[model samples]
Target: MDRVTVSLDELPIRDDLRGQKPYGAPQAPLPVALNVNENTHPVPPEVADDIADAVARALREINRYPDREFLALREGFAQYLGHGLDASQIWAGNGSNEVLQHVLQAFAGPGRSAFGFGPTYSMYPLLTSGVGAEWIGGTRGHAYELSPEDAAEQVERARPDVIFLCAPNNPTGTPLPLDVIEAVYDASHGIVVVDEAYQEFAPRDSPSALTLLGGRPRLAVSRTMSKAFAFAGARVGYLAADPALIDALRLVRLPYHLSALTQAAAGAALQHATTMLRMVDEIVVQRDRMSATLEALGYRPSESWTNFVLFGGVADPAATWRALYDRGVLIRDIGIPGHLRVTAGTEEETTAFLEALAEIGAR
Candidate 1:
C-alpha cells in the first residue's frame, strides 16, 4: 500500500485563522509584573482556606459528572450581579473567553458580521474571525471614548449580527458613558454583548448594560472571577442575559463546561466578595497614585477606570518597554505602534516601574 500523502495547502482549516497568534500567553518572568492586569495580591489566607474546604467537599462528587445544568452556580452568580435573574437567565463556561465564543457562535457566524471599537480588547476580533464572522472596527473619540453616534451609523450601515463593547475597555482602561452605551444598545438590532471583565475597578457610577436585560433581549453582560476575585487559575466566567439568550448559550456550550472544582471555588469567592471588594479599593487607590506619578514623569496616561493605566505618545514605546523589561518589570506592549499599557501592581512594584521609566527617559 502506498503511504498516505497530504499537502499543507489542501488543509481544511479556515483561511482567516492562518498565522494568528494564540491569546493570553505570557512570555518570560519579571520582578514586577504589570502586564496582564491580574490582581497583584494573592487570595487572602482566609479565602484560600475556604477554597480548600470547598474543594475537599467537592472532591466527594468527583466520581460523578458535574451538575450539567450549573443551576445553583448560575443562581449565585445572578444574585452577585445584583440582577434578579434565575438560572434560566445565566450561563457558565470554562472561562469568560469560552462564554464569549459561544456568543459569537450563536449570533455571528457565516454571513453575519460583528462590530466593536478599535484598540479595545484584542481578543474580540480574533474570536469573531475564529467563528468565521467579519469584525468591524470603529474609531474612538479624543479621549478613547466609543462614539455611539458613529457606532450607530455603522451599525445602521452594516447591520452587524453581533456587537461587543468592553466597558472600562482593556489596554486603554477608559469607561464608556451610560448614554453612549444606551445609544449603541438602541441602535444595535442584533445581539449586544457588554464585556465587563474589569468592572470591579470602575467607579460606582460606571455604566452597566446588565440592568437593561429585561428591556433588551439583545443585551448580555459577560463577567469573570479571574480579575478582582483573584481566580485567574480557576477558569470560571459567566453571562447574564434574557432567559432565551441564556438558553441559546446552553445549546452551544459543551456539557459540564465548568468543572466542579471551579464551580465550588467561584461560589466560595462570591460568598466572600467583601474581601475582594476591599482589595479592589486598595488597588484603585494605588492605580490613581500611579497614574499621577506617570503623568508627573511626562507620560500622558489615559484617564483610567480600571486597575491598569495606558500611556501613549512615547518617542519609542518599544524602547520604553525594553527598558522596563530590563529592570525586571513586565508591562504589556500593545504593539499598536506607539502605545503601552501597565497594570497597577503593589506599591513597591509601582515604584520600581516609575524608577525604570525615569531612567529610560533620561537616556
Candidate 2:
C-alpha cells in the first residue's frame, strides 16, 4: 500500500477555522523577553523544592488516574479565595482557558452568541467561533475602557448567551470596575464570565467580580496562578462560581483532565502562596517606574493595574519592536496599530528594556 499525503485545503475543515492560525505570542530567544506578560521571576527556591518533593510523591500514584473531582485542589482554591467559598464552588482545568472553554461549551453552543469589549484577550472570539457561537464585538472608549452604561447597553443590544469581562485585561492592563460588571449582569440574562487572569496584579481596592458571585448564579470569575504565582508552566487556571455552575463544568471536562503531576505542582505552589506572591509589589513598582519612564520618553502608556503596560504614540510599532529585539530586549506588538505591551520583570530586566527603547527613540 502507498501512503498518500493531503493538504488541509483538500480535506474537510470547519468553515470558522479555515484561515485561522494558532493563538499565541511569538516565541523567540533574546536576552530580555518581556513579551507574554509572564511573571519574570522564577519560583522561589524553597517553593520549588517543596513542589519537587510533592511531584516525587505524586509520581507514586502515576499508575492510577488522577482525582477526577480534584477535591483537595478545589479546596485549596476556595481557601485562597476566602469569600465563604467551598470546594463545591470552585472548578479547575489545565488552564483558565480550558475553564472558559467548559463554560462556553455549556452555555454558548451553535446559534447562541457571546460578546466582549474590544481590545481584550485575542482568544475570546476564537473560542466562541470554534464552538459555533456567534461573536459580537462590543465597544470601548477611546482609551479602551468600558463604562457601566456602555456595558449594560451593549449587553442588552447583543442579547448574547455569554459575555466576557477581562479584568486587568490582557495586553491592555486595565481592569473593569465592579459597577460595570454589575450593570452588565443586570442587563443581560445570560452567563457572565469575568476573566480575571491578571487580577493579582490589580490595585488593592480594585473590586473582584468574585464578590458579585453571590445571588448571581449566572456569573463566574476565572483566575489563573500562571501570572502571579509564576506557574505558567504548570498551567493551573480556575473559576469560582455557584456550586450548580461548577457542576455544569464537570459535564464538559474529561475525566482526569488535570494530570496528577499538574495537581501536585499547583497544590504545592498554593501551599506557599504567600511566598509566590512576594514579588507582586516589586513588579507593580517596576510597572509604574517603567510607565513613567516611557511617558517621559514620549510614549503614551495607559495606566496599568497589571504587570505589563500598553503604550501608544509610536511612529512605527514594528520598527520599535525590531530595534528592541536587535538590542537583545523584547516586548510584544499586540497588533493594535501603534501600541506595544511590555511585561514588568526584575529591575535589571526593566532597565535593559527601557535602555533599549530609549536608544531606539533617540535615533
- Give the alpha carbon lDDT tens digit for every residue of 99-155 in model 1: 999999898888999988877898899889989999898778777776668767767
lDDT of each: 0.84, 0.91
Clashes of each: 0, 0
Best candidate according to lDDT: 2
- Candidate 1 worst ten-residue window by lDDT: 18-27
TM-score of 1: 0.95
lDDT of 2: 0.91
Error of 2 at 20 (Å): 1.5
For each candidate, give its TM-score against the true structure: 0.95, 0.98
Candidate 1 ranges beyond 4 A from true positions? 1-12
